[model samples]
Target chain A: MNKTLHIALSGLNAIDSPGPGVPVARGLREASGFDFKIIGLAYENLEPGIYMPGIADKVFIMPYPSEGIAALKERWEYILSVSKPDVVIPNYDAELLPYIRLNQWLKEKGVASFLPTEEQFEERQKYRLTEFGEKYNIPVPESHSVNNLSELAEKGKHLGYPLVVKGKFYEAGIARSPQEAEDWFLKISHKWGFPIIVQKYIKGEEFNVAGLGDGNGETIAAVAMRKQYITDKGKAWGGITVTDPRIMELTRHFVTKTQWRGPFELELMKDARGDFHVMEINPRMPAWIYLAVAAGQNIPLATTQLAHGEEVKPMPSYEPGIMFIRYSWDLITHVSSFQEFSMKGER
Target chain B: MKINPNLAINDTGFAFDPMTGHSYTLNSVALEIVQRLKQGQTEEEIATGLADEFDADPVIILKDLLDFIEILRNYELLEHE
Candidate 1:
């Protein structure tokens, strides 16, 4: 009989702004050489993944990271009491710090998580993107973190009008003038908080690579995609794999420099002159990760294996032209399930 | 307040409003309150019932119910009386 490994996953809220949990869980289910049960960690009862019957063998609502480590640890202890997971994969940015901090304790309990070193996680932060590029010798767009709204005018003039203004975490808007820059700054600040980024606008094609690193300065798998359809919020609604050796080389260099140990997405932009600049680095898998699995690489599964200290082979190559088009589906579920989960914190 | 006729909420806590074509998921407690409201339960009944049912503090239940009702209104699931 194949031994079943219990795996816990978070970021299951598949919605307009989706999370990476569902795709990661699907990849684990289809993963080669492993039989597993999935435990879903969710923040909201309404997160669609909780209701998706087969994906999660069981689901538990976790305390928000904002509730502080004590509450989070207590929740995890309760979850571990019910089921001992072999490994836990946290798929949200906000939840990452807690998981990373709890890594050693989780290992003491036999749960492993392949995550980046604290320095790696902190260096690649959106606010520190410039430092990342300079340190790694990767080409990155000139960007600065603005502390006050007044700085928008001075920075806009230097970077030229039409610079990109970005929130600390998510949302990026291009401002064509000083007025527009300040307006975007206020909008993004209001939603995502301060220290916004103003970047040299590279009016070019956007491409991304969803990759996994083995923590030994080698990329275990990498797949590049050029977004074909983008939503108003700047997410790829449809995207296709591309045959680009440049992105592969860039990814290798990045992995080698940082010795990054887990899944990551590199957002890049190609200028009119065909030069590519790293736009941002997402510390976790992108929501369109299933596309990489379809093309030829199973990144989420690979990361899971590496998490357990298993030796992994570098994926050979993937077919170009593989594509994914994301769409919304209405999940039909009963209120009782919601009540059971909410009242009991588990379902 | 009344539930929009075009809205359908299943036991799984999945809510759909055909008028807007936007679907939302609800927590278990929130789903129960919505169902209670649909059944024409008064705020007092809901507050008291939820507090008793969940073994929660009454003050917290009252606050939560009001917050959820406001959310329902925002989602267009609640019709203003």
Candidate 2:
């Protein structure tokens, strides 16, 4: 028998807690022929074994002595020494930069790192992926990168009311008018710095697809899910399996066109024109990963097998029209916070 | 608990209860337990059969079966016998 492939998932912060990553790991372990282990770098107390059973084989907690790139590098070195995984997959956007740096170090250490190249990373941060979509005739919203508040206001007016103001690299806030867009831009700029993108809000049904790409432009398995409900933070609270062939083909085309490697999720919104506009590409797993396993694609397992150069079988067809009610533990929590946040007159 | 005789369950795990206008999705294991319950099997007998079939501990199987029955009761899919 072939040796079991070992993998490590980084970034165990509170934001991208073990809650999300654990399911993916567990699904992989159950479905694929691999021995998966999660290496949580910070807050060992929040390790995977505590919450998620049968997912993490070993959890390595690194020293959290300080906060900075230098301290993080030290922790990475410690992690590399203790858990010598064949590949490292980062789980959060904030951790991407440091993991990229660690990837550079891994190249010298003779360990393979799975992440986008530096140039590709920079392009993604600039929303240049939209241009790639446009090349392949993938519908993208009318969006423009802006550097100042005046430019945001100008574009917002041009795009009309109900615009979405987003950071060039990440989700920021969705606003109803030019003033609201400007206010959102100012607030985010003050807190996280500038260069945001403002786009016309494409109103209609939204859908997201999760899949794994072979890096050679072949998508292994893909699952389409239509959002039945959404939280204010854009998390899918309820969804259902969709068997739309068009959505699947579009997702495959886009991922292949980008030559994307690793697990990816594409967010798409169907406009009033009945055209699907590409929203954004999350280069990691979504929160609803368990639903995918429950509905049957098992993307994390497929990705792990591909990473190990093992032959991955095609995903078996599953029943469509299956609805997933994401038990909303935090729905009440969000409602309370929204009330308090509104009372403060803050968006 | 009681199951409405009018309710129909398909082999593929789809359950339709006309009395409540509610449909349910049950895994194969849950479906099997529900079917046996509807066949008038006692809780202990159902647990014993499930334990033999799935190679699970009898106590754990009984607990899980009871929980499933409670869930069905809560959904109004079952009534007290």
Q: What is candidate 1's DockQ?
A: 0.01
Tens digits of lDDT, candidate 2, A246-303: 7778877876777777777788887665478788777777767666787788876666
* Cα-based RMSD of candidate 1: 20.8
User: All candidates' lDDT scores?
Assistant: 0.86, 0.66
Give the C-alpha miss distance for residue A245 in model 1, angstroms.
0.7
TM-score of B-chain for each predicted structure, in order: 0.90, 0.90
What are the per-model DockQ values?
Answer: 0.01, 0.02
Model 1: per-residue Cα lDDT over A123-220, one tens digit each: 98887888889999999988889988778788888899778999987899989889899999999999988889999988988999999988889899
True contacts kept of 2: 0.00
lDDT of 2 by residue, B1-81 (tens): 457665678999998654222468989998888888788889999999989998999999899888888888766577546
Clashing pairs in model 1, backbone N/Cα/C closer than 3 A: A333-B12, A334-B10, A334-B11, A334-B12, A334-B13, A335-B10, A335-B11, A335-B12, A338-B28, A339-B28
- Give the residue spans of candidate 1 off by over 4 A: B1-81
List each model's interface RMSD: 15.8, 10.0
